[model samples]
Target: MSSATAPHRVSDAPSLVVSLENSPEAAAAARDVAGDFLKGLGPPPGRDASDAVVLIVSELVTNAVRHSRTRACTLSLAAGPGTVTVSVADASPRPPCERNPDVRGAGGGFGWPMVRRLAVSTSVETSSQGKTVSAVVAREGGPSV
Candidate 1:
């Protein structure tokens, strides 16, 4: 690939970033922000999509609290032309992992799967200081206003 033929990327997404204390109350607050962000999306006519966004918020926040030992975490929301992105960052150096289910198991190990189903794309990135889990979901055919 040459410079002249390189792909172009747009950098116009609107974003909100928040640093939250690592506590159960903070987690609940993060979910509320995420839910509000989703509700504030241009398409306001459908309640179902907003509900799905709330579900995503719950899973992501829960995972951060359960697996991380960070004193604080950051929640970021970015809105694009057709999609919304949610990212949660924690100070834990450990990457998020999924648990293998046992046939006899009836609980646990279901958060990641539920996130995958709700979001169009989900990813985890780790740095020397911490980790960030990001998920993107499309808001297609939603409210026009």
Candidate 2:
């Protein structure tokens, strides 16, 4: 289950928020929420950008649920002038690590790499209680460099 709330928006739109307890369905739920949110943006983010946002949402939420040694996490999305920022805050201090992809087996470690390549900007903020991972992706109609 997820709960959502937005910070007060003065000149801009409110951020999209979703709270998810660690569960197998968390990733899918996040993707759906992201897709829906993108549709509300004035001009569509374009096929590639829209797809990237959903994929990023899935990868990040999945990581929080599968790796974070915590019971819940929050997924927040904010749309800026030309970019969409997706952030997942989990109750864990450890940051995400990348490992070589498992081609033949199921020791899956591909999520982090895909996320890095898709987001033009990425950040991780760690605290005593947890960490928040954020990825910023540019919209197609906006600046690419």
Candidate 3:
């Protein structure tokens, strides 16, 4: 039972936190944790919001694993009425950049933009030790494609 496999659920708050190793597998693990939390939210927000939130979680965790210079990272999810806030924290203060997309899709400059487009709001907080990227996604309709 490691941090990666067992996520920490906050009893006082509508949120969940998961510790992750900075590897490709981090994204999958994050999605699982996010899905579990979303499933408990009930009918109001419905499936679309949950799917979008999970995707956002996947993208953020993937970015941290791929770009951050750390052994591990943390994924946090906080749910609101019709929205969820997804945050990924790693031991790097550098914020993510939105790169030019590769039309041929050989290179990946897509995830960041897609994240921006999907979230109701997005932000990055940096500290001397690390940085956290957060996004708010709505349960119903979100950003325009």
- TM-scores of the candidates in the order shown: 0.76, 0.87, 0.87
Ranking under lDDT, best-scoring first?
Answer: 2, 3, 1
Q: Give the runs in model 1 whose Cα sits over 4 Å from its true position.
A: 1-13, 101-107, 141-145
Query: Which residue ranges in model 2 land beyond 4 Å of their true spot?
Result: 1-14, 141-145
Q: Give lDDT for model 2.
A: 0.82
87 Cα displacement, candidate 1 (Å): 0.3
- Model 3, position 144: C-alpha lDDT score: 43
Q: Quote the lDDT for 32 in model 3.
A: 85
- Point out the worst 10-residue segment of candidate 2 by lDDT: 4-13
Cα lDDT tens digits for candidate 1, 11-85 = 222667776666667656766676666666676414555655566766777777777976767777787777777
What range of 10 consecutive residues in model 3 has the weakest lDDT sum? 4-13
The alpha-carbon lDDT assigned to residue 136 of candidate 3 equals 92
- Model 3 over residues 2-102: C-alpha lDDT tens digits? 45545555443377777888766778888888887877775545567777888999999889988896888889888787778899999999999988999
